[model samples]
Target: MPDTLEPVRIASKIMKINHAGEFGAINIYRAQIMVARLFSPQLVATLEDFLSHEQKHLEIFGRILQSRGIARCKSFWLCGIGGFCLGLITALMGRAGIMTCTAAVETVVTHHLLAQLASLEAENDSEAYQAVQSILSEVLEHQQHGIEQSKDSLLFKPVSAVVSCATSAVIWLGFQL
Candidate 1:
């Protein structure tokens, strides 16, 4: 689908949003790991693994932003703070809550990234597009893992809906900022 937003503008916004998103994801997992240590010890390792992936993704976008002299997203640290709070709350709810949060946020992220890729391609912003492409596989994997893990969680439906909405809102806000 053709984007209503201009291609160049969308491409730059995509990079900023994705960078901020990775920052959010990193904090989310960090908080999840902290709580999982007590409430769901078995999940700590997986959380750590996810954390590492987010950190790498952050660097990928960060480097692009720096090289291109694009300013960081206006919402960058806000995302981190919000992410940690969301993570703490969800983690307190237990494993299913953790999975639900991941499922919801990643679902929004995947949709955004796919759309971003299309816009970036249209703009011929190869550097930004390639950077986005490189991180998409792992984002998909995270989404898949969350979907699989939360399939049986009682909290899946409601929690996912709320978190997904919140995630979408944040992404939208990033663009506005």
Candidate 2:
């Protein structure tokens, strides 16, 4: 590939990955909401709201990918499966687990989105830049909510570390495959 073409390729791939990640996010919230309805009814509304945002995000990326004639990342289904399982397991732990998972995943996601935005800017791809930029505020809000909800510093810190690391690993693998 020509050196100039490399950025486009990377940007395209990242967009696809971001789309797939949104799928994962949607599933996470879905699973959480499922459990929350029974155990944490107060949280159901919150989880549903986040899920709606993720749905919008997924649509944004999907539309962009379609316009560019790009397929979704191969990891899309894998992410959905992993997200559901992760959400189920965490929701079982109640608020702490749910918030920890959200905080950790969104932390990694926020960092990657910024990096991806920089790459898009370098490429001067306004469509991609705007797409990534649009979802950032909600993602940040979700992160902040998670951090606030998890009152137990002792549990939050350690569990969040583990979840964040795993989220990072998954992202790396997504870029690779």
Candidate 3:
């Protein structure tokens, strides 16, 4: 690809992956909420709030994709299904598991977003930079919330390591497609 086209391609791929990530996040929260209702009623509200945020993020990325005339990532369905399964399984493992999964996923996601922002800035891609900046704070918030929630758990470290690795793998695969 030409140098000028490289940034556009990168930005488009990032947006597509971001949109798909939000879709997966929404599904994950949805699955978590469903299971939480039965085992952790107190967490229902928090999960719902996070789900709403993910929904908004999804819309923001969707608009970016539309404006750029780029198609959504091919991994969208994979993300949704895989995320739901991960959520359901983690919820079955209880509160710590759920929060650990969030912390892990958000940790990887935040890192990716920061990397994207740096790349966008270097390329002077203001449009994509602004779009990414708008959501960066909330992504950090999600990561912090997950950490706080999982603080008292004995399994946090191990669960987080495993989940984070899986999240990283999925993100790498998404970008390759």
Candidate maximizing TM-score: 1
Model 3, 59-95: lDDT tens digits are: 9999989988999999999999989998998898899
Error of 3 at 45 (Å): 0.4
**Over 4 Å off in model 3, which ranges?**
1-8
lDDT of 2 by residue, 59-158 (tens): 9999999999998999999999988988998899898899989999998899888888777888888998999999999999999999899956567988
The CA-based lDDT of model 2 is what? 0.88
Better model by TM-score: candidate 1 vs candidate 3: 1
lDDT of each: 0.90, 0.88, 0.88
| Candidate 1 lDDT over residue span 46-70, tens digit each | 9999999999999999998898899
Q: What is the lDDT of residue 138 in candidate 2?
A: 98
> Model 2: what TM-score?
0.94
Of the two candidates 1 and 2, the one with more favorable TM-score, higher being better, is: 1
Listing every candidate in turn, what is its Cα RMSD in Å to the true structure after a full C-alpha superposition?
1.5, 3.1, 3.1
Quote the lDDT for 50 in model 2. Answer: 94
TM-score for every candidate vs. truth?
A: 0.96, 0.94, 0.94
